[model samples]
Target: MKAIVCHELNGPAALRLEDIPEPSPAAGQVRLRVRACGVNFADSLITRGQYQVQPEPPFSPGFEVAGDVLELGEGVTEFAVGDRVIALTLHGGYAEQAVVNVNRCVAIPPAMPYQHGAAFPVVFGTSHIALWHRARLQAGETLVVHGASGGVGLTAVAIGKQLGATVIATASSPEKLDIARQHGADHLINTSHDDIRLRIKELTEERGADVIYDPVGGELFNASLRAIAFEGRILVIGFAGGTVPQIPANHLLVKNVDVIGLNWPAYAERHPTVMTESFRILLDWYLAGAIQPYVSEIYPLEEAVDALHQVVSRKSTGKVVITVGD
Candidate 1:
């Protein structure tokens, strides 16, 4: 079997393709013949040993994958060989085969392509849990999404619209803002050229947004609080903007706003039922053509470094993926 190995904490640039022995399924796990692997920003962080959840060195750096089941371990009776499925793994998704726990794999919709299936689990699941479960975003509410062109941001946009919210999307560039608009954003704000708080205020007629979905922290979070409406909720998705923002109690008291922390990985562990339900909703949405993930680019396994570069450099528009095979 061939795999991309990060033998040292050098970085994504130092990742190399090497021939390695295949791994078999362990107890309560399933072995999959990987067809596609999703390249997330966390993959870059994991390779460089910067992410909070760092595995020991000499590891493969991928999380979500779509493939065919080759074998199932003991006590696994829900699936069988050759079943097309998507697996969410802690690591080792960059290989030709990956072993994931039976509880972590889900059957992919027959109509969904491998590229999109590979990219779906993490970002879409995170967005759904944040907006629906944590934030309790209601229909007809005014919703603001920061970094709206990225994978997680766009997923929020799609889900917000589907739930009947009036979605306002913000991006660093006009092109990215346009991408958000195409994904059902009711209004677009280019934070690079326009002041986000001011633009959002004007767009909402000075009432402010009912909910703010932010993956980009730092100064933007402060501004999001200022632009929040009375009794608004702010969903802290991630700190993709390099700095984690601090929320002052005074600001929260002024508008009665709630700043909710959304950690999907932790939530998935505590509430496995919700994770399954979220995947089911996403699969139904994909089948109905109501929500589709935007796969910006796909690279071969050998070009995994380039794929990571696209994300780390912020040059990629949507989810970037690595195709293990065709």
Candidate 2:
């Protein structure tokens, strides 16, 4: 089997394609003949040994994939061989085969393509769970999303609208803002030049956002602190902007702002029922055309380095995937 191996921690350039032994499933797990894999910002960090969960050197870096079950492990009765599925592989998904726990896998909607199923689990799971469960976003409230054209950001925009909030999307460029608008964002903020605080103030008639969805941190996170409404909830998803802000507690106190952080992957094991139900809702939304995935680029498995580079360079929007096998 072919896999992208990282033997040293040197960022995306360290990823290399090589022939590796195929893995077998353990108890409660299943082996997948990987068809497509989603490349995330964490892939860049993982290859460089900067992510929170660091596997030993000479490992593959990937999280989510769409594939067919090649074999079921002992005691795995819910799935069978040849079942098409989307799975959450904590790592080793950028390859021809990967072994994932049965609980981490979800049956893809019949109408969804392999590429989308690969992209679905991470981004959709993050935003849907954050907005619906964590933040408790309500209808008619103003919802603001940062990095609103990128993978998780775009999903947040779409889900905010679906949950009945007036969505304000902030992106670095007009083209990105346009893409966010197409995904149901009611207002667009070009943060490349516009003042994020000023724009939110203008859009919300000076009250500020009711629920702030922030995946890009650093200065943007700081701006969100100023732009959030009184008693508003701000969902901190990630620090994609290269810097993690040291928030001032006094500001949060003054506005009665609630800062909530959601690490979606943790729920897979800690609360598997909630994770499964979240995917079920997303699948139902996909089947009804209520939500759509935007896959901007699909690279072959061997080009995993280039795929991660595209995400690190901020050159692609929505999700970028790596095609593995048929």
Candidate 3:
């Protein structure tokens, strides 16, 4: 099997494409002939040893994958060989083959392509669980999505619209804002020029946004603290903007605000039911054509480092996928 292996904890530039031994599935796990892998900003973090769960050196950095079940491990009865499926692995997705726990695997909808299946889980799952389950976003509320043109951000915009909220999208450029608009954002805020806090207030008629979905956590998060409506919930998705904001308890006290931090992957381990239910709803929406992944770029497995760099540099919109085989 060919895999992109990271021999050091430096960055994506240090990754090497090499031939690796094929892995077999353990009990309760299934071996997959990986067709595609999703490239995430976290993939870059894991390479730098900055992610929450860091495997040792000499490992792969991919997290989600879609492929065929080549062999099923002992005790796995829900899936069979040749079944099309998507699996969430901690690592090793940037390879021709990956072994995944059956519990983390889901059947890919017949209509969904392998690239979409690979791209679906992380971004869509994160936004759906964050807005629907965690924030309890209401239908008539005003929702604001920061970094709205990026992977998870775009999904947040789409999901917010599907949930009936008026979504205000913020991005660094007009082109990015345009992409967000096409994805269903009701209002656009160009972070390059507009004042986010003022814009939200203006868009909401001084009431401020009822829910703020924040993925870029530096200055934008500070703006969210000011723009959120009273009793509003702010979902902290990530710090993609390169700076982690320090929250002031005074702001929360004054506005009765709730700053909720969401680690979407935690649901897979601590609350499997939540993840399963979220995926079920997302896949249903996909099959119904209500929501679809906007895969911006697809790179071959040999250029896995370049794929990771595209995401790490924040140069690509929506999802970037790495194809393992034809």
- Tens digit per residue, CA lDDT, model 1, 289-316: 9988899998999999999999888788
| Pairs that clash in candidate 1 | none
Using all chains and alpha carbons, the TM-scores for the candidates as numbered come to 0.97, 0.98, 0.99
Sliding window of 10 residues with minimal summed lDDT for model 3: 305-314
Which of the two, 1 or 2, has more TM-score? 2
- Number of the top lDDT candidate: 3
Tell me how many residue pairs clash in candidate 1.
0
What clash count goes with each model?
A: 0, 0, 0
Q: In model 1, how large is the Cα lDDT of residue 30? A: 97
The lDDT values for all models are 0.90, 0.92, 0.95
Off by over 4 Å in 2: none
Candidate 3 C-alpha lDDT tens digits along 145-168: 998999999999999999999999
Query: Which TM-score value belongs to model 3?
Result: 0.99
Better candidate by TM-score, 1 or 3: 3
Residue 61, model 1, lDDT: 91
